[model samples]
Target chain A: MPEPEPIADFYAVVPAGGSGTRLWPVSRAASPKFLHDLTGSGRSLLQATVDRLVPLAGEDGVVLVTGAAHVDAAREQLGLADEALVAEPSPRDSMAAIGLAAAILQERHGDVVIGSFAADQVISGRDGFEQAVREAVVAARAGYVVTVGIAASRPSTAFGYVRSGAGLGVDGAPSALHAVGFTEKPDAATASAYLATGEYRWNAGMFVVRTSVLLDHLARLRPALHDGLRRIAASWDTGADARARVLADTWPGLEKIAIDHAIAEPVAAEGGVAVVPGVFGWDDVGDFNSLAALLPSVDGSGTKILGDTSAVIRVESAGSVLVPASGRTVAVLGLDDVVVVDTPDALLVTTRARAQQVKDIVAALRERGEDDLL
Target chain B: MPEPEPIADFYAVVPAGGSGTRLWPVSRAASPKFLHDLTGSGRSLLQATVDRLVPLAGEDGVVLVTGAAHVDAAREQLGLADEALVAEPSPRDSMAAIGLAAAILQERHGDVVIGSFAADQVISGRDGFEQAVREAVVAARAGYVVTVGIAASRPSTAFGYVRSGAGLGVDGAPSALHAVGFTEKPDAATASAYLATGEYRWNAGMFVVRTSVLLDHLARLRPALHDGLRRIAASWDTGADARARVLADTWPGLEKIAIDHAIAEPVAAEGGVAVVPGVFGWDDVGDFNSLAALLPSVDGSGTKILGDTSAVIRVESAGSVLVPASGRTVAVLGLDDVVVVDTPDALLVTTRARAQQVKDIVAALRERGEDDLL
Candidate 1:
């Protein structure tokens, strides 16, 4: 089927950040998870995210917001025009990132609807993703903060959940529902119970909102942060010097808050948030174990290789995740559910069950002042 | 304690062979285990073996017999004189390696008692080892093939077992006993049963016997191999060209038999074999798990590092063996009893329980034409 026509009056804003400490050695401070091709898809996660959004938002309507240090890399990978990229002078959390994008897009083209998708996430079922975004755009145009709630595939405690109340009864967004509440990562039992209730969906941190609506919500909920982002966005397109001046002046002072707490939670409570069912498969690709789930098994033993298969030699080893990124041969013997991530400067060996604890290793390295490895 | 005087007419024949496939990536065919410091003792196993014997055999009495390709490396590490090193034209197993050394020593010194020790075994308790060798030398002078049998520390199935029988009653060799028989690596149940019997000891492949007695046994049991070694030994001292000519002509055709099958087992049946109890701590360092036992715990968690400890970072990982020989930082998280052998060109990740299966990985790599990794 041909690609769906670009959504009218809609812009896609991709906020690429997070050090992804748990995926260390592969995901590091300088290059993080979004810059690597975690899925062996040839395209980096940031590039894949832009690729997914460009057709929906139109080539010119897609905007990228990333840390200043990563601007060159993200631009080189995505090949986005300079004006379409927004580089934050410093990390001020998701609020400043997405808000700055929404404000800048409003400054460039009137108050258009902007969808905020994290560049580090993985999503499949492109048609389903497009349909959800289309419906989310309609809900956003109807003056409600819209979040695409992923169909909870598992009772995972890795992500927060969004609770749908009643159908929004919007003309174009048939699956849109009134978002009643948002909850942080819940306990295992609570997540299972939420799954049983059929109303909870994984909050993928994806928000589609009209520029005016998000700015109004942010102004009411976090005035200082809203003012700082607006000031930065106002000069973003004026000139490189002016943009740099405003960013350096305002970005550092912006409140460090995730978008969830800044707007989604309060707005949902005030009956101004809508949840569109995202039937597409989605994952944050949090750790090696989660990465194993995203990768296809390379052999009958369920071994997954993210790099050169020829570089890995497994004997009686099953359910292993091997990342032979160092251009060296890796030999695994009689181990099951093992994670071996080999890089040129560092190597990580752990088990699938212990993948999340990789962050502890990174923390210990930091504590020991091995920042070069981190 | 003062060092004991050199034994009278005793020569040390160190057969430095075996690719140590079970310890691959570190123990390659080119370098092998004997050339590696698996115990982190700052000396290669071959060097330590020679160090242990230099005092007992006198500097000129110690001879190193290894493959032609490894001669230079062994000589570089050992600094042995050209006359003290025997380089085989090709691998012909233990019989050729040890017999060649015995014949050469006898041809030079006239029927001297020669002690054959593997270059790859690790031994502690220097005094006990010295005592055992001294007693074995006496037993060897009394016309019996003497083997040092290590006291069974555990019911390990990795090595063969030597069953001790009646005492030899040789003066000055009180610990020497008539060897009843030898058993290859047994099943767990048989190994446990062998350990229960007070008579069984781990066979460490150490043989002490008069060169005349060993050559005579070879003549009686396998005259062709004996004649071939005698011819090689005859020309070995004539000149470098003659020695190379004889070795190239005779060495390749020699029988490829381990000493146990060629002499030890059959000689025991004829009541000519004796075993001197070795009270020293010993291990072949068969695999990473066995290597772990040789290394002192680097942390309270019982983690063992065989190379630069600073290159390894462990978190919640207990009882793991790490060989960070690549000069790369190896981070291990939440894995117990895991073996991570990191090298510049190859890596091995396995568990202590499956350490023996590492050879299987090497075999698989070889099967896949990845001989460079092997």
Candidate 2:
């Protein structure tokens, strides 16, 4: 089969943020989840994210927006030009990161369709992912704020839900539907109910839209945030000194809100949002449990090993996830469905059921002033 | 309270052996359980063993029989004179270790009452322990092999039980009784039944007998083993050169059996064994669960820490045993009764219920040829 051609005038905006606190030692504030090879695929989540997008939006068409601290690391991984790598002075959450990238893409390459995908996510089924993105881009060009909602594989309470309304009836984007609204992570019963109705899909926070349309929506909904982003983008191409000055002056003061809250929710309510069904498998790898789900069982008994398989010696421990990142022997005996993450300086022991509470440990570490460990 | 005087001619024999397979990573063959302070006490189990014995058998009267590899470490910790530190060329089980200590004590200081105490046991209530030893010595002087039977706090199937027959009516040893026989680690129902009998006590393998009496019993019971111990003891006083030569030649060929099988059971059957009630708190710290019980709860909820408290950040985890021996942060979240042993080379994660099965992990490691970790 012939490879799909790169979409013309399309830009991939990778807003890399979130420390992935539940991942703890593996995903730190200095080097978050996006920078690590969570799937043991030899490529980091960020690099893999770019690898998937580069085919859809050519190498030069991809733009990365991440914290300034991670800029060098991101560049080292992707080898993206300085102009293409947009470094945020500090975290202003997803909205600002995505908004800034959208405005910059518009200012540099007028009115292009920019698809904002998170850098820290594990994805599989490359053809399906590319096909979904292609359809989403087509929907975006139709002047709708498009979201590629993942098929509800399970009633997961870990992610928000995007409810699909009527079909968009757009040409070339056959799977696209009008997004009704979005719901925050629901309780088990509510999530199950939503999954039962064939309308809800996991809102992966992927927004594909015309750069002009996103900026226009932002101007009407969040005028202050849009104006700040516009000001920064205008100075982006006026040399490194000017770009730094503008970012330093404006980045920190921008509104700190997720893109879902700022754009997806409000726009969906206005009937301007579209949901494209993503048949591909995807995960944010929220914790060790989610990470375990992404990794194949090294042993037949549902034991998942993220690092060197030989480093782990498991005995009667069914469904145990062991990350022997420290190159030391990790032995799990008679523990079923347990998670043991071993790093050089830190170790984590918990059950797959309690993996969501790992963030509590991070909070405790923070309260204990163990910032270095965090 | 007035301190008890050292019993005349009473020598304390500390047999420090056992790889403590169940407590692997923390207790390797090179560094066994006796060398570690599993109780969170400043002193090691070996040091604490000698400390408790010194009051009964003056500082100079304590003899530590350990593997040759651990001799330097034992000496460094105890500052024992060269004669008091009896280093075995190789392991030949509890019988060889204790019998050698007894035979050497007889060869050097004549027929003194020698008490055999395992170096890896944890004990509390020094007064109660000393009182038990005093009574046991009295019974030992009556020409019987006396054993200190610990007050069975629970129906533990982990330890052997000594069933008492009738009162010995010895002068000073008022509580001493004629031991009927010894039962190996029993089933749960059997242990519960034994505990209800009021005459049964947890046999902690503490034997107090006159060196001459023990040798006589060994001679009558196992003549070849008795002759071999006597031969090794004869050369023990000869210069280091001659001692090494004899040990190299005879140690390998000696019978490898536990003291329980060699003398305790046989002597008890022949009505030469006496049980002195030991009201002192004691534990073998056989596994992580037992070790957890020995350690004081760091949290109100049964969480036990063996190393630096600050290194651990536990959340919603009760009844967990954490040993952060590597000076690294160990975060345990939402795992109840879990055992996480973090060392520099190896890590063990299991549930308290499965702690006894940890030796299986060690065996698996040995199968994998991870000798360094062992």
Candidate 3:
């Protein structure tokens, strides 16, 4: 086999500034979800994502965009050189975080192919994942904002779907289908129908694009965010003040939209989208139940028990033994499909079906004047 | 009221020393149910019990009989004098523990009235409790094993009942008819019938008896334990050696039997047993459900929520919020009659019904080589 292309030029733009109440005790103002060592595997999701990106990006090209509040922590975790972090003043959506990263990356490395990935997802099949990413890089170089499509394993209503079109082979295209159209998450029935058709792919929020290319695309598609991003990039203090100024004055003005909605849908509707098919084991690590697939099961019940230490879990005089720790251990007693998480200030015991509502719990906490938890 | 009989002079014997798994994370092998600070009131049940007993026993006269492993912690909590502890070498049944306490008390202050109580129980009506102890003291001096009978409020299958005899004088003489006649824990229908009669009292396990009278009763009833206790007392090291010998030889031989079965039944069957009727707020605090009743209620639901600074006890997150340090703030998503205990080591999400089976969970953990949690 021929040697792989120069992977060191592959860069990563991680949007790490999503503020949420759902992952409270673990992910707070100072410690966001990406920085959380949820699996107790020494490295956090952000750290793990960096580690995963290392084979491609060589650490120098890795870019992390976070809220002003978590800039210091994000920097310490990624261990990057100056200009690696594109700190935002406030949390807009993925569109702003992604756009800001692209502008900064263009200034440093001239139009390098960048992989804009989330810091929270977990992917297996490392070789296949790497290969899929490499294919996206070639499509990106050919002037297409490339998106990876995961084959549907279940009728999951949590993600948007991408329907494939005819293969478009220009040059150096990896095993992939050409983009037909992208669908935002559908209702349960639509999701079930999509799963059965085999024409749908899970929208994984992963993309490969040229930095010069995404900036030009955004300038034409969403000009307000594009103009604000240009000015913030010009006034780069590389300090905390720059972050505060950008957040207080500019960030709140940007329309809160996912990149897929602001850019990918419009591009796909025009039939110029390139889809990278992935058979790799991938997980978004979306909720507590999703962790069951990423970590070792605590019991035979696909329950995951993860904590920094064992003292954090304690099962009473009953047959359960759970200690108290930041790690998570699910004890499936006579009851099944439950997730019990214990933190220092609060305790969460919820069913998997209601797991998505965990975010609502965080929202409720915020409304109740429990500022400390948030 | 009535000057409380200048605090009844007696040696108190507490027979509960074993670890209960139901209240797992808080309760441990070294620290069982009695030691956990469930109320967050800065005192444990053991501390509460000692505080309740000290005035009655003239401080130093109170004796505590507990398992050997807990002798140090029990001493730390009680601050009893050197001679106050009658530590068992191994765990024996209540029959042996009662006999042991009586033997030691008889040796120290001959013919003194002895009050046997449980360290883990909570009692209200302090003045009434003291008054009942005084009455029992009078009966004990009169050579009757005085059992303080709590008036049964509901037909509970958890406790044995003391059948009230024909009305007696303040002197506790068997003038009208017989003494206590039966020990019964009836079924629901049977218990309901018994409740309607108003002749039955919950066997509170609070017994007042002359040391010599109890020894005599034991000798006639359980001769082997009676003989074993007497011999162990004779060789007992009012020094450390006695404890060593008690643990080495006599302890394992003592039969594990409750006082109701071993001594009270025989005395009631024989003669001269006085049952002092009481309506005090006497609760065993048996499991989470009953234990919840003891705490200050929220929304009149008879539920409690103990959380750290970061937790928000929401409308839906009632019934359970045990924040055991570690600062892990738990968010109860959607639960009412559940206990969400978040420890740093483990997370327990359980209903009150299954809480009593917490030990089964501990057992399963141990079987799975999770002994460190136990």
Candidate 4:
């Protein structure tokens, strides 16, 4: 396909440190989000994210940013080349996780372009995604931070959006656009209106920018973060300082904010950001409910499960989800649109209408210290 | 109490030759109602019935009557003395089952009184039940078929009733009443009206009668049954009439009919039956639904289940009879008056409104040849 244009300059950096409570029970404290092979793709979302990035960044250039607590699982599962992972001393939110990666890359590769990616996501049409990221890189190298935008389908109030502007050139060079604006997750009416505009894209929390560009932008937009990151990088050579001193001091001190709010939007509002439409399908597997939706349909009618459920049921009971085996002869008589998740210590039954609340149920369970179920 | 009344005349003849599809999973093709130790009471209902008789029949007279397939379980669980046990050729219904027992007793014991009882019934207050049966016998010895009437507390539409007439005779015989009339299970309004009158007593399907009295009544009333019974009994000892075997040739040919319709009610309607009210709690453990009502409060205020219930749940889900421990763990949540029955191969989650139809469900399952569930 056009000799498959080489993906260079841009390195993909995944922030793999989220303790996603939204997928508790299934995704637990011991082995958190990035390690869950939730989509049954035979690879954790983190591994898949890395694989997806390899096409866009060339294998040797990809790096992962995760917490000290999770570094072991990350290394054991992702199997990357040497010096490819950065473990934070403690976990901070997106801003710090991203800032650490950018600062680390800026010192190592100078002004090389990097794409910030979240680990919990699914993407299809890699060829198209690579093309989109390469296009985004052009904008990033031309002195603008470009956040990949997933074209909006429905009025999902759960995600932030980028409002598109005019195209820049034929080669899409410097792929410039006077970005209209950025909106954090909106209310229903605002999202509905945004959806109608056709140019709004769900902010995938993914952004493309040269290492120097992100750090330089952070210096201007959040000076404290820029300073802290520089200090953290200087001590990396000692390696010992990386975990105990540098990260402990840096992660907790970095802005408790999203990258959009702390850097890109602030930079964009000042007329220095670009938006590139993501041409491939991408999903942030934010929770089990969403994760179930993305996995290969277990029933051929959309059922996904894991484990031995023979002890659970022996009949489908007319289309119920029995975890372990989606079609374990379980009888769900008089029940509809329900999920029967049978685990060793606990079982859960809730309709799809309330599936999102399972995490809340698990939260209450955790609060009671009934970790047996967890 | 009154020297514990000697626990004598305690012979129990459980007529279990009737196939009751009303109880399926437990009462199956090879094993029927009387064979089931449903309550884990250390004694099955039939076993309990025998124990009830033991106090009076003095152990040796505790007789068990079951169909051909169930003869082994009945005898094994009841531990009846040889010749005290009776096996039918097939399910000939209670009328013929009771007839075969009566005729066999007629030639062998001469003028002995007999207590004919259903095997699938739960009776508490054993001392009180023994007294009630003894009282019924006293009345029966004086030329009457004493049908024990359970003291009716609720206007339940699931049972037939006996109209208790004014008291007569002495011991005060206060318990004995002339059975003015018999009524089959009535509609709600009629049962409510019957309850208001206070003259109705639930038909317990238990009878105490002098062998002579029963024989005379059967000969006068259901001639066909009496003749069939005679032929069956004649076959019991004499292998002479090859085609007249009690457990072989006759049982399957005997008309399928309830003892109530075939004899008791017919005699009561003809003014030849008497009623004796029983204070002891007696329950026909007819179905899992009935088990809920009869078993000691399954819970202080929620659902109760027996057997393997991993398959059954009664959420809020209260008042359900889940049988998961019959093999599985049955958990009920957020439901009220639900019946979750978990079996090895079958599970039933039904609402209280449809509790009566559980038999229908079992029937449909049988018709579908879902034998595993059955």
Whole-model Cα lDDT per candidate?
A: 0.92, 0.91, 0.72, 0.69
For B1-374, candidate 1 gives per-residue lDDT tens digits of 87679999999999998999989889999989999999989999999999999889999989998888999999889899999888877888999889988888888889899999999999999999999999999999999999999999888888899999999999999989999999999988999999898899999999999999999999999899999999999998999899888877887788999999999999999999999999999999999999988999886999999999999998888999999999999999888899999999999998899988888888888888876676
Candidate 2: where is the Cα deviation over 4 Å? Answer: none
| Per-residue alpha-carbon lDDT of candidate 3 for residues A215-275, written as tens digits (9 for 90 to 100) | 8888889988888876666556565687567656876788888899888888888776788
Better of 1 and 3 by TM-score: 1
Q: What is candidate 1's local distance difference test score?
A: 0.92
Ranking by lDDT: 1, 2, 3, 4
Candidate 3 vs candidate 4, lDDT winner? 3
lDDT of 2 by residue, A1-374 (tens): 88778999999999988899988889999889999999989999999999999999997989999988999999999999988988888889999999998898888889999998999888899989999999999999999999999998999999999999888999999889999999999999999999899999999989999999999999999999999999999999998899889888988889999889999889889999999999989999999899888898786899888999999888888998889999888988888998889999999998899988888988998898988988
* lDDT (10s digit) by residue, model 1, range A1-374: 87678998999999999999999989999999999999999989998998999889999988888888999999889889988888877788998899989898888888999999999999999989999999999999999999999999899999999999999999999999999999999999999999999999999999999999999999988999999888888888888899888877887788899999989999999999999999988999999999998898887899999999989988888998999999999988878999999999999998999988999999999999998998
Prediction 4 global C-alpha lDDT: 0.69
DockQ of each: 0.89, 0.85, 0.34, 0.16
Model 3 iRMSD vs. native: 3.8
Best by lDDT: 1
Residue A366's lDDT in candidate 1: 95
Interface RMSD of each: 0.8, 0.7, 3.8, 5.4
Model 3 CAPRI rating: acceptable
Q: Candidate 1, after superposition: displacement of residue B225 in Å?
A: 1.1
